[model samples]
Target: MHFDLVDLRLFIQIAESPSMTQGARKAFMSPAAASARIKNLEESLASRLLYRDSRGVELTPAGQLFLQHARVIMRQVDYMKNEFTEYGAEASGHIRIFANTTAATEFLPEILAGFLAQRPGVTVDLQERLSRDIVRGVMDGSTDIGIIAGPIKADGLQVIHFSTDQLIVITPLEHPLAQRKKIKLTETLSYPHIGLHEGTTLLRFLNEQVALSGQTLNMRIQVYSFEAMCRMVEAGVGLAIIPESSARRHQQTMGLKIIELDEPWRVRERSILVRDLEALPAVIRALISIFLTHDSARERRS
Candidate 1:
């Protein structure tokens, strides 16, 4: 009987966090109290909610179903709040968006700012996540829109063409590979490389491709941001493979060379994904229109 929005919020936190105790801390509840509340919630709903394992917890089938409804309820609650606030001030609503590092690093910021500038009423909450996680967020109704690198599986969502980003190799001006117009990845296997962190999509792709080809990529240093990797490359530490957009910016002033990667995977075809394009809020739909139109124009010009 004590279950309410607080319980739902805690439940979502628990689902996302590594452990229930961590979720409890995030929700500002004692672990024992959080456990008791979840038990009460399960009993009230007449179903088991979570499967506990040594590593962490996972949702049961019923928990997964409940999570979808919970996210919708929470999003609607936020919308209602934003609605009243906007009604009082005649402002646009907030939209939640997720994207991969490629989009977040090289694409979304300036375009989102321009779009928001044109429509002062709308506010946005953008987050960087892996493509698969972004897809999951859209499918679960937790995110309004997602931009991701494609040729991906998106089972119950609408996908729209965004942009195709070419990948390039970045190297210091003195590096041997810098002089090459286009070079195969295998040609660089002998040199030390600057790599992105382990879980990043591009890094994983590079690792998988190298492993598949029976080549070992010697990662001398790993960095979290493309900018940092570029800086390291400029310092003559090692070379990196990054999106052309990222490499071009660094090339302008960093004295770095951008070599076009001569591989089929050099092109990262990206797309915008949504759970229900027609059901999007008016402001969000308008924002999407602006973004996609601009991107398409750029693509055409290129």
Candidate 2:
């Protein structure tokens, strides 16, 4: 009935990664050893932790509960280590972030690069997720920070507003939709649309909208990035809906036309969600400040 930090950490890693083997690699252990350790841990706790399948693994109800506490325990351990080494070492810690598609793809890459450049000891694990899922991740302590957009409620969490951007439609210059300055979601659903990949947040949101209108989106192709989506649109594959920031950037070089979305939900505020910002580690707070600073610079320019 006894387990140590290694067992806890291994379980957490397996729970986060795509496969036990991948998690083992991150933990600097062999897959066989990792499997054995997990088995022993389950036996000691008298409960199953993961559901295994060909696709990789999923957390069982018990496993999800375990992960919640495991993350909190690991964070506290990190805090203790940092306090002990305050005099001898520079600020150092790992920050786990969950962000919606717009923030993750449009904004974070350059911003994170600058943050990392200045803080050599800090590392980040970033994932793109739906806004609701990001809220859940923050509530469960599984994520250190979440950058979410849209009308998702963060009732109990501390929210910090950052950037405001809208979803804009892009089409080939010769496309019929390009002749208009603005278009509605309903107008675009009938046309062949270039979508982001299957599991992306924006695609899911678009699907929900199409469902409400009693029609289906004609998703001709799915690409992995904003640039790819724009490229497909430029090639006359289909229309695309992307963040204004990304659309503007790609439109400058591609033969794509930007059309404003005539929907209220099109404009969304991107914000930071955290359980308690001040309770976070110093390294994490510094990164948050960087986001705020970047937003301020954008504000001044606008």
In candidate 1, residue 228 scores what lDDT? 95
Off by over 4 Å in 2: 1-67, 83-90
Local distance difference test values of all predictions, in order:
0.84, 0.87
Q: For model 1, where is the 10-residue window of minimal lDDT?
A: 82-91
Q: Best by lDDT, which number? A: 2
- TM-score winner among the candidates? 2
Q: Give the per-residue lDDT digits (tens) of candidate 2, residues 1-302.
A: 88889988888898889999999998999999999999998899898999988899899999988888788787768765764554323357778999988788888999999878876777789999887899999988888999988876777899998889889999999998889998889999879999999888899988998899899999899988999999999999999999998988888899999999999889988889998887787777888888999989987986
- Give me the runs in candidate 1 sitting further than 4 Å from their true place: 1-46, 50-58, 80-90, 116-123, 297-302
Model 2 error, position 93 (Å): 1.4
Model 1 residue 41 CA deviation in Å: 5.9
What are the C-alpha RMSDs, in order, of all predicted structures? Answer: 4.1, 4.4
